[model samples]
Target: MDELDAWFPYETYRPYQREMLELAATCARNGGIAMIDAPTGSGKSSIVSALLAERAGKKVIVAVRTISQLTTFIRELELVRSRKRTLAYSYLIGKRSLCPLSGGGDVYRRCEGVKAVSTSLMRERAGTGQLVPSRDPVIIRQMKKLDTQHPIICPYFIKSRVFTGGDGNALRMLPSTTLRNRADRITRERVLPHELREMGAGICPYEMLLLAAQKSDVVVVNYHHLFDDEIRTQLYGSLGIEPHEVHLLIDEAHNCGEVMQGVMNTAISGPALLQAEREILGLRRQLKQAVAVTQIIRNIGDFMEGLRNSHEAEDWFDPSIFDRIVVRGSLYRDLSEVVDDLMQISEHIREKNRAAGEYATTAVEVLTAFMVRLTCSAPDPAFLTVFRRDGDEIVLEVRNIDPSGRLQELARSHHCCILISGTLSPIESFRRYYFGELDVMTKTLPNIFPPSNRMVLCAGDITTAFSMRQNRENTDRIARYITTFASLAGNLAVYFPSYQILETYAGILEGRLSSRNLIVEPKDARDAGDLLKTFLSLPARGSSGILFAVCGGKWSEGLDYRGDLLAGAMVVGLPLAPFNRVRQMTIDYYRHKFGSDGEFISYTLPALNRAEQAIGRVLRAPEDRGMLVFGEKRFLEPRVRSGLPSWIRDEMAECSIDSFAAAVKKWK
Candidate 1:
């Protein structure tokens, strides 16, 4: 047995951590993909870091699903470095996420609340400081500097100064009177030129990951960026690198299939079409007098009329008929024509009015973007769809559908690949859907905590469907059952399948439960946050209450109500998403592709995973005392129970929730 201090330096290895490290090291050595199924709080990051240390020179990309997860990973890396200082690391974000301040963008606007003492102090400090208008020549010089080396950073201060001045030489040419006025405005507003530049250049975390991946040894990003076709192509193809060269480590691997489906699916609506039509109309009105422009407008009007008559947007249109409607050829040629026409009309529409000229220029830029998005074909699997609005108009939506196969091809072209995750279970399913083969090696980590820490109870009587609605009699029975459990538990989070079910249960428990017991439902995200805050603030011991939440909701996943803060949970249904038009279409499409069983594989299974995630929220720490109760009877069936994890099944076998009240009373 290896002491925790030997390899981990943490004094002990949690069973799951040891297992995860073993699997990651094996995958790193063998150069194969591996999926790990381990619960949260299992020190997965530590295991991965150990694996990365062994593979010194190679780049590793860890793709997570949320900003919170990315932040945690970075913090964990920082901790690891503190313990072992041999690692070299840099955090990369998308080109757009780079600090505008660092890039020389005037980001002064973002520092509004921070008090600025005096301009003289700012001028004295040469290095990075919180001075409002730092006058240190070197710092000022660095702030003014602009280079293409950091493309993501925006020189917003430079841009703003030029924009406000109306010319590049505005600062130099300013008269003393005007200069004094500008200076006064700057001081009073506390607006620093350098600060404004920084604000504009600020990019999001997703963009940061993309940028970091290029140069950093380890890159952390959201799964959506790598899995989504449009984003993946932009990252790999544009970077001139094969996918396999960069290793991928997905943190929450279980959600990959569902995330892939979401990325591939696209939707178009009526209101969207009308908005696009308005833009087209504005463009047409701008060039009304030109012969070509007039003809194009007339043709578009005719097309809109035909679309209105048909009342269908999905019907295909002949490409030849619309070819003349769209301008093509070289980008320079398209820009030249638009500029020439605008110049000819400049005299008619007084250039003296700056706003008019600005509008025309802005329109030209918008048109340019539209043209590029329409013509670019370096990427593959591109498809175009059109829809019609109630107001006799047409809208077009273009997308790259199903980029997985292309991504796989890109991956195969690389020398080595590693796919690691904490929740990559039922490995065969992921292999079949993502890699199209089961050739990749698989591994599962042992549970980190003792089995007795958390208990799962399939309290198999809670039902909301018509046949088993909790009526007057059943409501009392259900309320009594929950009350009994709450008395024994510290904090309980009960999940209903829908808002209707939640409201129904809440009404039943109205007077029976104490006012101190906070009950939350899906009214809005803000409301949910408040409810969670109240629930967590309760004392760790003897904090008896009910937090009413919906299954597969915002509260279910990405939330931590661990330890004594959350003691028990009740799940009302299987969380099979209601069959709507879009879900039905998805089921039908997958069924046609793979068969009837495919729909369950595609839809039902994914929804069930979400329920599992919700239940997983309670049992966060090793010492956390928690029990999961499933209200739905269907969960007891072999088909549903078979898919559940072995640990969960063992917990369920102990005591079903149908006999919940008696069980709780006996335990108490």
Candidate 2:
């Protein structure tokens, strides 16, 4: 057996697994960045084993995009632990999932408030000679005296700790035996976030997992744990580790840009501004600049109101107009002064609310954050000021168009950074888009499964081009294509460019395909869970279902439609974002950044990535067989076709509706 097999966990390696492992090992050995586009079922999770083998005492952090992905790594590590019985690993999820407190508010803020109260009460008890507050009758009685409406005492947190030494100058706190044992079990066994919560019935699950993570050689966490600046700082501090001591593995990394942008983006809505005004009035007695800040908010609201006449659902809003309005309507000379004053005011309001046991986010805080980003955006070309109409309200956003600068910084700060995904094909484009001139290794692995197990087809007769979408002939052709694809026997999904398009196609296909159950993706997320659950269960009952969903929507990415759950997937059109002034600005920015290929990199590449994610759902494993169809003719175009994975491009058969029907019959 090879020396690295000590970390490999499995009895045997899959095809090309050793190659991807070597890529990860090289990344670890050289302390550089590597991007690997390994198709699904390539056992990409095993990359963690390579990182572990190459970790010369440095810790490995696996950042996943979803719970299922996290569980995959957890299971992989469990297998590793069976071989290396001394292996120590743990995982961290958001406190929202592990917190036992039942309430409706920002989980972080609520956690902070309760921790503050818990610490204060414990310290008070310690001063009174009751060092073991978790066991103190007096402290328990004191906790009971608190108002029931707003829970200030977090019993789990109190139970998770125990003080050591004297209560005065030599005071210290350590994890209780129960907490330590629970956390140790987490490191020894495969404990998911939910299981950790169950194990921590009396102790704090987050605290237990955090303790486990501190001693762990490997830690699994969500993207925000490392991508969001504040969260990363806090998490690293809590774990007592520096970025240089960590080797990073980002799973499903195709979504990294979007997730990083989410962390960098800031927005303030009209209702939020109105609420800020109300908050200012309520705290007018305490805020010395309350009057000025209130007027500035109204001016900002008026600025948004003025743009409501544009008749466009979304558009770019010149930041200069905002500056003019704030200066002209308020006593502030510039945005810096306005933002500084708002920051102090928002801080004061937050502190007051915390004191009152109300930890929910206030609008003043949102306004302050937005203004800070707006002021900062003046010097940052990557940031854009945009507005969109949400019913009767106008929401302003400071959107970050490029997540590379931050991602690059993060990559350079780590011991080694490895990004892996199934759809990060055209690896050179992603390398340029993500790292610019930063020297990084790129690897693209072929489909390890047999080519005959899946069939990829692209239509040559239809397009959802902007000009052609309104054409009745085009609409009729798309409906006919969808209905034809629906003729398959098992679960299938047809992804459209937008919900509007999905609804239009749904309307056209109504009462046309009655044999298959139709499941339309909801506009809101409330019902998405139930919708997906219902869709997945259909195949087991020997029923066929067709899911009409939008590309890049909830159902498109970050999901596995394994085996019979999804027999075929058809992408209706290129999922290009609707063109607007903001999009144009983004294209212009990228064009300037990437030169001739800027438009393709910034605009076309993302759309194609979405379509790839949609159609790539078929054939999750080596034995899983399914059909893949690209409904748009653009997929046949050289530029777009070249951007897709080599496996699909090589196996794809171009066909029209009649030809597709013939292929479908043969496929069955």
Candidate 3:
């Protein structure tokens, strides 16, 4: 606390801020791991940054969950550097975020051919942080000098040259350039942003960041950069850093566990398979080697098409049919052989496209991934190897009902693994599910925000029990209940259990509320960030807007709505599992893993976590005040209350709609 007190930006620490720093200090001294759960407003990022900055002879790597979330970390580090005088870090962007040449305009489409030629090479070698010469820089330079504008050539040339064992400048430049820095400005030394890497450093930013990691105190990255082992290995290899020398600081760590499971999960869609068959067909004219592999994928596509046709005819596809086919001993070996063959011929197929054939490469990747998943050992006693149905597509996923084995492997390799988030309740349950017997410290800070500043109201009349989901009367009642608080003078959000509920109630809301005042999140909107941005920008009377989004989606977690912009949140239903085959398998796995507490681990806890996240979106700062209403009769029931968070369960008020509305008005 004394060391951080000098550098922290706030006038005073939140009650838990000093305590969290002390815990972090203890973990550092003992060389052990710690899991700390502080609410959203408790300044987790700041304290983590402060620890990294203040600690001596050690480096911290903070893996954030999203690129959009990276800004907060960077901004916090800047604050610490202003006074702490120990901020040495870099923003490491991925190919998706860093490679400007791979995206945008017609030059981007033309760049795709070179990208395909380079993709295979990138898969082979990590850059040595040195340049070799090729036409990539010249071509990119010409493209820039042409009738069109060019993206930064440094990043493109690095991959095209370095990947194939030849080289050019390895950094990409952008039109988002600025005047050159003065000698003092460049020499002053500060954290580097991805956009300015090429212009400021005159080196390949990606390679530069890796080299910089060896000398710097911290490397800030997104979760996928570490969650995926191959990518993680490339990072370690490039830096020559061992596991014991590095400590991981994971933000939004609850999602980190899910990300680990997702990494192991692989899927194949219908269009993707059909596209692979078409891409493979094009390879037939050039080489005879394509024939055997082409036949395998063709047969696979035919089988998939047959299933879809059967479903169209009978209204439902049988899970047993897919499961039986996937498990036959001979099937696994055949799929492995095909994957090997296809991987050999994939580059040739990609080359034939001539321009941008991302679709074809993507299709090949999908098939290879699913085939690879089929070959890997299943996690443990229970898991699914079957293809599941997702509206018009059959997704073949290697679902690991158990993720602890892989997570433990990662934890054991790192010097310290700290999983921090706002909603890591029942920390023991998280440890059981995510780490098995791995030794670690766990702590939770009491809610510093008072009951007077925030309120969680439970509805006594509404219930979204599975049995009543489809009933018109229930939907109508739920719709009416939302309008009660939504009509108030505040920016509000209503979260439903699923898109079906959101859409159904949204239609009912159409009659009561104007279309102009509603922002309904789609079940699978590609860009949710944009959707939220659009919602906040609309002309409102006084920061009083209304948005309806789904629980456990882009908006339900991670997003911070602080202040008057989001003054109230209404959660419509518990995020319950339907009586489906996958659900049954999940329950069976948990029952095997946790015995009696299995149900809570598998169902009740997950639902409450989502509900808790929704309620948390409103009260984001110390002075912030908001209303949180959980509008399901199940929420107020003894069985459900027994499992909820202490702050929520203890202060919740069960009230009639009229009385609740009056109280909210009075509080405002």
Candidate 4:
């Protein structure tokens, strides 16, 4: 038997499962980066088995974007442990989910303040005769004295641990036996974040998970735990794990660039400046540098106002002009000096607020962080400074155009990195866009599901181009196509390029489709969940429904439409972003970096990916039969056609609206 057999939970291998396992094993043995473009239902979750087989002593960290994905791996690890009961695993999500304390503040900063006070009180009690400070009478009294609504110290953290009886030199701390027992139970059972929170009535769930992670062979975390620098540093430091000792696995690898960009981006708004100026003035007598900081804040506001007057919505702003305003308005000689003063004042205010049991983040701290990023990223061409109107306020933003440099740094810092996603088609484009010139291994697995179960059609007559969208003839054609598809037996979803397009077609077909239910995706996300619940119930009631949604919106991705729930889907057009100044600047930056292929790689590929994601909602299982329609003439172009997955390209039929109606009528 092969060594990997011990880790494999199931006795049978689906098509290409053994091959993917072996490739992952090899990648783990030889340290570097590897990208895998495996389709859904290819047993991508089982790749963790191969990593476990090869992990000699290093810790494995699997990062996911959402809670559902994290739960999927937790179940998979449980199966692996069924084969090897001694294998242990744990997971860590955001603090907002795990924390028991509630207040209007940044969770991380609030956690820091509470943990500091909790640890200090615990140590003082331990200095006396009380070894377990949580049970100490004096400590309990102090904690009870704090306001229940907004306590400065955390009761969960205090109750989560105990200290060894000794003096300062020989003192030590350990997880309470009760918390350790719960941690052990989590390794043995399928405990989700909410479940763990319930289980932790009196203990800190995060502390319990940390205790489990320290002894386990594998640890699961959210994407921010690995993508953000401060979070990564704090997580690694707590785990006592170093860079070389880490083996990283990133699921939904397609979101890597966007997530990294979010970490690097920073902004300050006009309203924020007003609040910061008020804060500085309130501290004028005590803060020595208050006058200089207040002037700088006012000048920055004026600078943003000037940019807003010159640009319509969003456009590039000169960083040199910003620096000149700051230095000329204040006593500081350079931008860095002003940033240092802001940082100092922000920290002072934070400490003062924490001492008063008010853990809210001040507006000045937000400006301080933005200025720091602006000063630090000015020389890098990948970072673009722009001003845009958001609602009623003008905001200045520093956006990171390309994430390849940060991705490269993250990949090289680890022992071995594996990024896997179901939608990473045209693997070469993604590799170039993610790693630049870095030597990275790549794989594109074949579609394991039978091709007979699904049919794809690309329109040859209709187009949703900007110029033709308003044409009465083109609008009627689109309405006719949707009304025809509404005659099908089950739920049909049509995704448009934007909400405006969706509303245009929806308005034309609102009362026209009385035979079937018409459900349109809401702009507000809080209302979307309830509407989705309504959409999913139509098949069970023996009723048919047609949904109008926009690509890249809430309903287009991260959803599971299983058998009969979604019988067919249509992507109305290429879901390109709105052509605006901000988008053009991003395209121009990429063109400079990637030469001729810049616009296609940066702009076109993402739109195609979003379209595929919407269509891929159908055919979730091998036995599931469904129809997919690409509702635009541009899909027939060679460049766009070639970028689709081979499975889609092979089964696709190019048709006009009349032919599409004929095909749907004849479809099984």
Candidate 5:
């Protein structure tokens, strides 16, 4: 206990940190899924750190949804290793991030399997029995030094890439265990800063990590390592790791189902189909198979024409749609073969252009992948085929209507799994949708904050319903409430259901709250950095700034607005997703299949998840006091209230502005 405590950054554990650590350790030893709901400031990372440092039973793989999270998780790993003397660990990311030299050249992308791992090389490594990598520090240092000045495009293991492509009797790096087994071997240790920088000089980061993981106790990676089939097969097979030998920890795990859905789902845009036709024309000039390629191009034009003539509407159907498309005799098989041929040729073209050192194969590769996905079989009944119309063509979206099947597979594959997040509630629906029949252990940690530090209230008179929103009287009432609330909190933010609502209400409130600056969120998420920077730079002590952002959009989640940057919120209207045809059909499908609870699962819970996320932004810490006003009357309804976080559901009440102001003043 003392040894593990030394690895923890904090002097002592937070409220639930100890319990979380114990639970995670038990999950590591046993086998099943553990569903945990701990709030934002619950020291979730600290618990995960302690688990890895102390529990050395099974190999640990920490998977998260995004790169930012992977970076953060690795930082914690660094701290644990600092205390434990040394821990071998690395982040396995997409090859593109680590390769700056693969562009504008014939230098094939690092860690490439597109060409093929030479079979002769694998047999050579096997015959020699020189499995353990032990190149000197001098050689590594020289490469790192060279890379710092001029990076090279070193596509390492051009031959080793095939060891696990389909064969299993290949090289297995000797089943190296944790630190206890490899304590004296420095070459087998974790890759440090300069070494990683050296790899960016063109070494295959994927293969490097596979060697490192052989000696590592904990390996951190993006969820793609587990969910994306191509990456999973390449990485696990190369590491010689079986599913049951590993334990998985998923942070921000609410999005686990979404990750699997992304791997399973694929979309073909209107423009890509047009481009594929053009690429076929180019192939006609290069290859003898011009006639066959020309036919596929003609079929694409016909398909586009059919979509243009049809009504512009969205429809959700089942797998039967695939059979109907097959009957049309569109070149499903030929399209697949054409993509493979084009890819092989593109490699050569890229090589020929190596001297010019430029790359333009991104679009071509993306189009080929989309075509390939269209032919995949979705045997799962939960996969829904959605068709939506665009101008000259239609976009076909394949979405997995449920995540239970994949979640069950993931659970069975690992020694055990831990799924934790701040908003993992409505446990019944989450379990039903994500875990299905698996027995999932669920736990919720109460928010650790002084009750008086935050206030939750709803406006009984003001309703942002479509019917009442534009009424002159209701507009004036809404404007009056926002202006008054703005005066109470110095630095605040307001959220809307859409950019349209943001524009509508901000204009209406401008006349009343002219002193406050209204900085709106950018329409595109990528363009939000400067807007947020300007907003965060404003004085946080007064009502001088009010950023208008749409709920569930650019500024809603993943932003840290503790203490000054955020003091209160005006979440205007329920973010009830419009009853679009697809949405209604989805609700109807669930209602017909599973009943009323299914309807709630399909519709109501998602809306509240966003609403809860919006409200949670104001109170970042125990000492930071803030206020929230729900502008929609529907928020006070029983169904909506049930979906909110327990802390809000327990304390929130309908109150007039006068009473709310007095409560905030006296709360201290």
Candidate 6:
């Protein structure tokens, strides 16, 4: 294999790349589900890509959390293709974003009038230098005919006319016809790869997965597309297939439970309901002119009053109970009638304001749908939340709880599923929530970085109780510690739990550390980047300064500040989220679901994951040297410390921070 490796661009695998790939291959062969817990820079991409390349006949779908990650994976795949000269791939974006023109479809006829006028202008310029506008009804009719069928395609010719200053020269410039001819020839050959087929080009990746499941071997998408109820229904409903037909690979599987809960939970607040009532009332005022609007407004008012009354009875109304109040019989009968009334009035308003056009209709439809969905009874959890903003107006928000079951059902129907991520630890929790009865294979790869090179420190006394923002004495102590620490370190990044804490600590250290370079996380992205750049570029004196940041924020993850760019990290707090009603309710919800100790599964564990993610930021490579400072005292607790990975525990036993200044002195 080493000798054959000359054919590849990269010579070696990173950490457990081969093992993960082997597992993936085994899973592929047996048609079983596999969950991989590989850390960042662990070459998970190569492992997955290898599996994809080997499995030519089987379509593999890769789903990630963000579009940016998807794009990155696509680029990595492209790089592999460049080296291996095997496998074919194409990007499938959301269906709404698919280009109708690119697919050789006649979906642009809606803009035929513009197309015709533009074409006429082009022709007139071709024959004569003067621009000519056409108003002939016959030409207009023909253009309208073309527009109705090929709106997206015909618009190019129209746009060409505009670009060419109403001259046909742009159209005459050719190449499109030649390209089309080439495409036609290619299509006839059938030798072109399945990925080259024009069939699934314009559909969303999720939709494309459904369409090409039997054909293409691999599909990639975000976590939301697979887990979100709306997207899941759309894909499954359109494909008419069960989830079991597809293999499951959940990348970033650690966040699966959180994503599942997020999709499943729905909340509506009192203030938002009140605002909706006002808006409905405003529409009702137009009732003298539009009876439909008036009737719809009255119905909305009734619904709002019922919602308020339900809330008044209890602080929280279970979605099931609320549904019993709103939805009756079939067709969402109550809300459906309101939708009909609103739709009628909206149409009238649209006609009256032709300039307003689709916007008016769209708004009406959105509101109508909202009302209908609000009133419809579903098995999902729903909550009514109230928020008070300034200016005397209260906001109400309504949301559904736990859409994960629906998503999982959809995934099972599809067959093969893959969930991948760096942070999925204590994998059982995620599996219990996401896969449930579905059998799943799990693997956790060792940290990609060599454990010996990086030093992890856990300060025993750093607690939120002693946090600077919460206590002035603690602020002074932290500042003194940081100043002394900077005297020894070349470069450092100190992470705070929140912006308030960062600001408070930075204020304490203001004038004392003038000689030392300092960078603070700005409130905005561009500013933050700028600060990081300044810090990175600063001359590396034997003892440099600090970069202050917030934990679990943009700078903490998705950043590489290795070597001298970052020498030490002062983690001020455990990153436990502040106490809030919603968080309390979330804790209660989990407690009810999984017993009293379930709060650990629901809240505490996730918070610890975030702290772990922050710690991960400092150690980019095995050769990097960094000191991790945990300022929170609660982290010393047995329960909290137990949640940390084994490697972290081993490191903490060796390098513990007693006093901030003393800990700083020991960094080197």
The window of 10 residues in a row where model 5 has the poorest summed lDDT is: 157-166
lDDT of 6 by residue, 1-668 (tens): 63223223466766677777777766665665667777767766665564553453554556676555566666666666566554444333443344333222122222233334455555654455433212334434544655332232233343222222334344342223323343333222222223433633322222233333322334565666577767755554544544554554556566666676566443333344444345445555565434444444444335445554332322333444433444443334444565566556555554443321112223443454455455553433324332323233322234443334654665555445556667666666556555655788788777767766666666554465533456666656666556666676567777887887788878878677777767788878877767776777774534456778888776776566767777777677777776556566767766766675567776777777788777777776678767766666677788777777666766674223345456556555
1-668: candidate 5 lDDT, tens digit per residue: 55446668766778887787667666765677787888878877665664565455667788876665666676677667666666666656655555433333223342242223222334354445433222323323433443322223222433123222224454643322332232223223444433554543333444455566666777777777778767777677766777777777888776777678888876666677666556556665666554464565456445545656556466664435444443345444534466566566555445543323343454345555554555454454566667777544577677766766777887778878888778777666777768766788877888888877777888877777888866988777777777777776456888888888888887777666667777778777677888788778776434358878888887887566877888888788888776667787778767876687877877777777777777778776778878887877788889877877788788888976566556556542
TM-score list, all predictions: 0.66, 0.98, 0.82, 0.97, 0.79, 0.69
When sorted by TM-score, best at the front, the candidate numbers are 2, 4, 3, 5, 6, 1
Q: Between candidates 4 and 6, name the one with more favorable TM-score.
A: 4
Superior candidate under TM-score, 5 versus 6: 5
Q: Candidate 6: where are CA atoms >4 Å away?
A: 1-15, 53-56, 66-68, 82-84, 92-219, 222-248, 257-393, 400-403, 465-470, 481-491, 513-517, 522-545, 562-565, 654-660
Name the candidate, 2 or 3, with the larger TM-score value.
Answer: 2
Candidate scoring better on lDDT of 1 and 3: 3
lDDT of each: 0.52, 0.89, 0.67, 0.86, 0.65, 0.55
Encode model 1's per-residue lDDT on 494-567: one tens digit a residue. 78777877887677676777654857766677677776777777765445567888877777876667557777
The candidate scoring highest on TM-score is 2
Query: Mind sharing the TM-score for model 2?
Result: 0.98
What would the per-residue lDDT of candidate 3 be over residues 228-313, giving only the tens digit for each residue?
99878877776677767777788887776678888888777777877877766777877665666666665565557666544321
Instruction: Pick the winner on lDDT between candidates 3 and 6.
Output: 3
Q: What alpha-carbon RMSD in Å does predicted model 2 have with respect to the real structure?
A: 1.3
- List the candidates ranked by lDDT, beginning with the highest: 2, 4, 3, 5, 6, 1
Q: Candidate 1, which segments miss by more than 4 Å at Cα?
A: 1-12, 16-19, 54-56, 93-153, 156-215, 228-242, 285-423, 466-481, 514-516, 540-545, 580-585, 588-597, 654-658
- Select the stronger candidate by lDDT from 3 and 4: 4
Tell me how candidate 5 scores on lDDT.
0.65
